[model samples]
Target: MTITSKGRLTLSVAAFATIAAGACAEPSEELIAAARAEGMLTTIALPHSWCGYGEVIQAFKDKYGIEVNELNPNAGSADELEAVKANRGNTGPQAPDVLDVGLSFGPTAKEQGLLQPYKVSTWDSIPADAKDDEGYWYGDYYGVLGFAVNNDIFPDAPQSFAELKDGQFANSVALQGDPRTGNSVMMAVYAAGIAEGGEPGADALNKGIAFFKELKESGNYVPVNGSAQNIAQGTTPIYFDWDYNLLAMRDKLDGNPPVSVVVPTDAVIAGVYVQAISAHAPHPNAAKLWMEYLYSDEGQLGWLKGYCHPIRFNDMAERGVIPQELLDNLPPAENYARAIFPTLPEQSEAKDAVAANWGSEMGVQ
Candidate 1:
């Protein structure tokens, strides 16, 4: 039983807990009713612009009539983990019920006992490498690294990592954040390392660090947060970020210089973000419902509209569940299918390696 501002009510935690345990019995109707009774779900670190979450949240509201209170929309993966830990046992709107974070962060959150294990109905459809066996976290979608260039500034944008080092893009290359903290920046380094002939392992990031060091010494490598506005204003003409983000920027900033996204032929690195429920979620049932919806056909297609490749994409395509037009709008499917993906251990090791050497090797704080 729990009491809200509206009134006092009784809830069956056992039944809902069973649903979260991925039991053999179906509890969809019960879960829906309970979530509706709660009438709200709180989430953190979901930027409306990233991966079509703006439309996804709206669609969830329209279907369930459950209000979603999104907190710290721009928070990063670390921030999301801290929010859950700090707000544990507090039943309030600020206590996040769900979390979406970098793949490596999922295991960290679980290790810290901040996540709840809950498998959606479509669990079997998700790839084994992308999910936890106990279901504490699962990959929602993935994106490959790319260069988003402002064509107005450089008519011939740097098409490869080799080109970026030729002094042509001096003082123009912008990374989103410190590789020590930002997953995107870290993966940018990973991709660069692979391009520099480093092996596909965590230790190989040293080569990427060396490449960036050379780039910085050559008067390139601007240490500024890259944004669509920054690109439009020519502050950072060459931005390294995810293909989905760069592609979305092209659509978002439609006419101002026009954004062009390119996947460098030398190296392709892919990263995934996973979804999990907070261990102390104030709205557990709603969180479960949200996961269920995300893995559903409608939710997966919603992410596709935002240029993200859903985890179940191939399965849906094989079954012909995805619309033809949506399929047509995506970038070359081979680009994503053929890219290299690091294992969880490798990702964790790489993140730690960058955190240890980013400042000393890259000369950026």
Candidate 2:
């Protein structure tokens, strides 16, 4: 998916409202009352600090007065899928009501009958390619692959992937998580593959795996998982992660190390995470309400605060609802406008390839 700077990024919020009123029941007071009576929402693998979830969760609870039980804050995308399957038929607190998974996992879960179809009110504002036709899941937010440099650790940061493997950053570079299960690492490898002259679609991951092994052999790949805490503690200084995640770290750190993020010009890949309702959600009403709030203008703005590019960002921008101050901090819209995203089919194929080859090819297992 290629998003251009001017024409495509501007979508009117009024269009969302019109679609919401026409298709859905306008999220009536009865829905809210029912959700409040259900009194609980169970979720899996949503870390608070990632992509404004910290604020988003608190806001939902404060508004609805419902209890939210978040399970396994650090679980990977694959773990999320397993939990949904494992807890089926058990309407207990441990059973997840919703899932926010890597884009590829969304379709796979839907195919296995793990997801239920429920379109949010703002669905019309979302790009067609970013959502499933039947609403089993929809893209929520996205970020480009970029380098998050701890400026204090290396004042002259590596601006490109080539520079990262140039022998100056040996034993320093680290990926956010393991590629075998985590989408972030997988995309990082995919982008690196593009830099190394591989093809555009899922089949190009072989080149990415080879590149990582080369980095590993050069003693440059730090095998440990990367995190904001690791960067702050000086355990992992040169971190390769999503632009939003790294930008949030900078705000969280507040100049402790003065992180500088760079979207590599040589190779770029934008990964989007999708939101879905569990097939057997214990609190189905609450789960639906949560989706309503997430896609609302309020929710979209909340994601933008954490530096994530929300699915309806263009629509909000056109309606002039997005804050000017927030827009100021965002990288030029063109930077993301020109980004390339893999189609759902491409993501599915790539994920399969990674599952089969990542461990043996990159020695990451």
| Cα RMSD for candidates in order | 9.5, 3.6
Q: Candidate 2, which segments miss by more than 4 Å at Cα?
A: 1-26
TM-scores of all candidate predictions against the true structure:
0.90, 0.92
TM-score of 1: 0.90
Error of 1 at 329 (Å): 1.5
Report lDDT (CA) for all predictions: 0.82, 0.82
Predicted candidate 2 versus true structure: per-residue lDDT over 1-365, tens digit per residue:
44333323333433443433343335769889999989999988888878889989998899789999999998888989899899999999989999998898988999999999998878898989889999999999998989788888888878788888878788788888877788888889888888888876665687777778888999888887778888877777887888888888788889987888888877878899999999999999999999998888777777887888888877666555655566667776666866888777777767777788888877545
Q: Which residue runs does candidate 1 get wrong by more than 4 Å?
A: 1-27
